[model samples]
Target: MSERTRIPPLSPFEEQAGFTRALRAGNRIVVSGNVGVEEDGSVSPDAGKQADRCFALIREYVEQLGGRMDDVVRVRMFVTDIADADAVTAAFSRALGHVRPTGTLVAIAALYHPSWKVEIEAEAIVGDE
Candidate 1:
């Protein structure tokens, strides 16, 4: 079995929820739902801006796990409002267009925080890369 590695989350919720933000087993890395909220607890109401922040945080985790954005093979996005799909898609494309990873968008009733508008998760493979 490959050794599993994990990264701490920016929020205390990770501990409360009993989960890590990122995990790696061998060359495969899995990133948990990344929200747009900053370390200072500020959240961007705009879906696009929120998506941007989520993607950036995911990228940081990927790199920390010995991978790159280009290594991302799958992406999942969650939004509170379906109308914000365009904004979320635009931000996702802007960040990972060249990678062209398989993606899914989901509409959820709510999130951990009331003000949060978007969240994202990703999977990456970086075998010997």
Candidate 2:
């Protein structure tokens, strides 16, 4: 049987719901929904800015767990407005560059915070164990 492992909990906020921020099994890492809250826990306004912040948080989690952005294989972006799709994609492209992981953009009614415009989740493969 394949053994399963869970990544260390990483949350900028003290009040978190019932969900791990990330999990690792062997060589693969799966990151949960990440928002655009700043280090001080302040969210950004613009979609592009929020997207950037989300990716930054995701990157931090990956690096903390001994993984790199290059290892990312999939990404999911959730936005409050469909009109912000281009901005979100542009921000993602800038962050991921040519890695070009498989991605999906979704429109949602709302998120945890009213100021938050975007949230991101990701999955990465480190290597075969």
Candidate 3:
């Protein structure tokens, strides 16, 4: 069995909630739901920009766990407002459209934070590159 590796929690709630930001085991990498909270803990009011932040963090965590964004096989996106779908989709295209990873986007009621409009999660296989 391959050893498990983890990317330490980026959010304070992760440790308290007993979850990791990302994990790698064998050839697979899984990233937890990522919100648009900036480095300073402030979130953008723009949905597209928020989506952009989520993808950026996902890419960073994926790479840190020994996988490239190109290796990502699937992605799941959640948005609190259906109206924000277009903006979120545009951001996703900009971030990972070239990789052509399968994706699912769904409209939800609300996020853990009322201000957060979107959240994203990703899965990658190291050898996919």
- Predicted structure with the largest lDDT when compared to the true one: 3
Error of 3 at 87 (Å): 0.5
- Which is better, 1 or 3, measured by lDDT? 3
Q: Which runs of model 2 end up more than 4 angstroms from their true locations? A: 1-7, 10-16
Per-residue accuracy of model 3 over 1-129 as CA lDDT, tens digit each:
888899876668777888888999999999988899999989999999999999999999999988899999999999999999999999999989999999999999999889899999999999853
TM-score ranking from best candidate downward: 3, 1, 2
Per-candidate RMSD, Å: 1.5, 2.5, 1.2
Ranking by lDDT: 3, 1, 2
Superposed Cα deviation of residue 114, candidate 1 (Å): 1.5
> lDDT tens string, model 1, 16-75?
988989999998999988889876879888999999999999999999888999999999
Alpha carbon deviation, residue 39, candidate 1 (Å) = 2.9
Determine the C-alpha RMSD for candidate 2 after optimal superposition of all C-alphas. 2.5
Candidate 3 least-lDDT 10 residues: 8-17
- Tens digits of per-residue lDDT, candidate 2, 1-129, equal 445565655554523665778877778888988888888877667889889988988888888777899999999999999999999999999989688899999999999878888889999999633
**How accurate locally is residue 32 in candidate 1, as Cα lDDT from 0 to 100?**
89
Each model's total of backbone clashes: 0, 0, 0
Candidate 1: what lDDT? 0.92
Q: Which ten residues in a row have the lowest lDDT in candidate 2?
A: 6-15
